[model samples]
Target: MTLPDFRRRKAGNQRISFVTCYDCAFARLVAQTDLDCILVGDSVAMVVHGHPSTLAADLPMMLFHTESVARGAGGKFIVGDMPFLEHRKGQSEAVSAAQALLRAGAQAIKLEGAAGNLEIIQSLVEGGVPVMGHVGLTPQFIHAFGGFKVQGREDAAAERILADAKALEASGVFSIVLEGIPATLGKRITDALSIPTIGIGAGPDCDGQVLVLHDLLGFTEKPPKFARAFGEVASASVTALRAYDEAVKTNTFPTEKESYA
Candidate 1:
């Protein structure tokens, strides 16, 4: 689907589905699913590169994954995430960073946060970069938020988040991702925006929902509270590996193929 198609889905009350993918194999796999968007999320720092935080990964790593995902994304819409501090320097830096991602094959870039990020988003949008704004428990703000806690729990905070969403929309974001916020506020923000809201840990009321592929596929041992495992891929991988080890140990793997000689 195209970026603009998300707005049409919002208009129709149809929910969008987004998932984070980092590599070509998974991107190709997701292309076969009914999902509407594949985000090459910066969560790759934690999921693929064994980093404890998203900040550990840089723009080059994110761009590498974006290229990998785009190689196999087929016709699926791809949103590349700007890594921690990738665009934090200033609007000029943000525009350059975003352009780098777009040049690497991202259809759009998901910029995290308000305040400083809002101005960057406006600058990038004006520069012809399609942006997806992210707010509410943004990982880049984890240290600032004192951990991955839910945001907008209080009236003032909720108002602030809602205001951020409004300002982002006015700045020309095609869509916004509401992450780690209360369900009531999630719905409130979703209802407040004309553009589609794709939620992760936000709530069921968003125009779309997203999850990390590793978390959703049961590849990660301990996923976040909001993530649900739809498959036991890790266990399946272990089982397959054990079987392969046993076959090789018993010298049975090449027995059938030996007949070709």
Candidate 2:
């Protein structure tokens, strides 16, 4: 899907399907499907590189993965994430960082939080960049929130998050990601914003839903409650690997039909 599709989907009440993909192999697989879009999320630091948090995702890392994803993404729209603090530096730096990602092949970029970045968002949009805003449990603010906990649980916090969503909408974000908040708040934000809300841990009432590819495929041993494993790929992969090991041990892998003259 393209940038305008995000708004059209929300207006038509059609649920958008977004998934995070890091590399070309997975991007190729996702491209073969009808998924709405692919996000080369900062979560790659944690999911693919084994970092404890997304803060470890630097601009270089994001560029590398975004380029890889773009190569195999086919016609899929790709949104590259602005790494931690990349946008906080300054207008010039932020735009440069965004330029690099776009040049690397992202159709758009997603950034976390709107509190201190509204002007930056506006600047990027004014400069003709498509941006997706993310609020609620912004993983980039993990330390500020004291961990990957639910946000907007209390009345005041909920109000703040709702405001953030609206401000982002005003700032021209085509869509926003609502993460780790109560179901009621998720619905509240979804209703408040004209742009689509892509929830992850935020609940099913959103205009759309997004989950990390690994979590959705059961590759994560301890995925969060909101992530439902639609497939047991981890276990299935292990079983296949074990069979291969056995075949190799028995010298049966290159039997007559599997060998060349």
Top model by lDDT, which number?
2
- Candidate 1, 1-261: lDDT as tens digits: 886787899999998999999999999999888888899988899899887778887888988999999999887888999988878887777888888899888989998887877777878888889999998999987789888889999999999999999999999999999999999999999989999999999988999999999999999887888899999999999999999999899988878666685
Give the true-structure RMSD of model 1: 1.3
TM-score, candidate number 1: 0.96
Q: Which parts of model 1 have CA positions greater than 4 angstroms off?
A: 256-260
Q: Which lDDT tens digits does candidate 2 get at residues 160-237?
A: 999999999999999999999999999999988889999999988999999999999999999999999999999999
Q: Which pairs clash in model 1? A: none
- Candidate 2: stretches off by over 4 Å: none
- What TM-score does each of the candidates earn? 0.96, 0.98
Q: Which one is best on TM-score?
A: 2
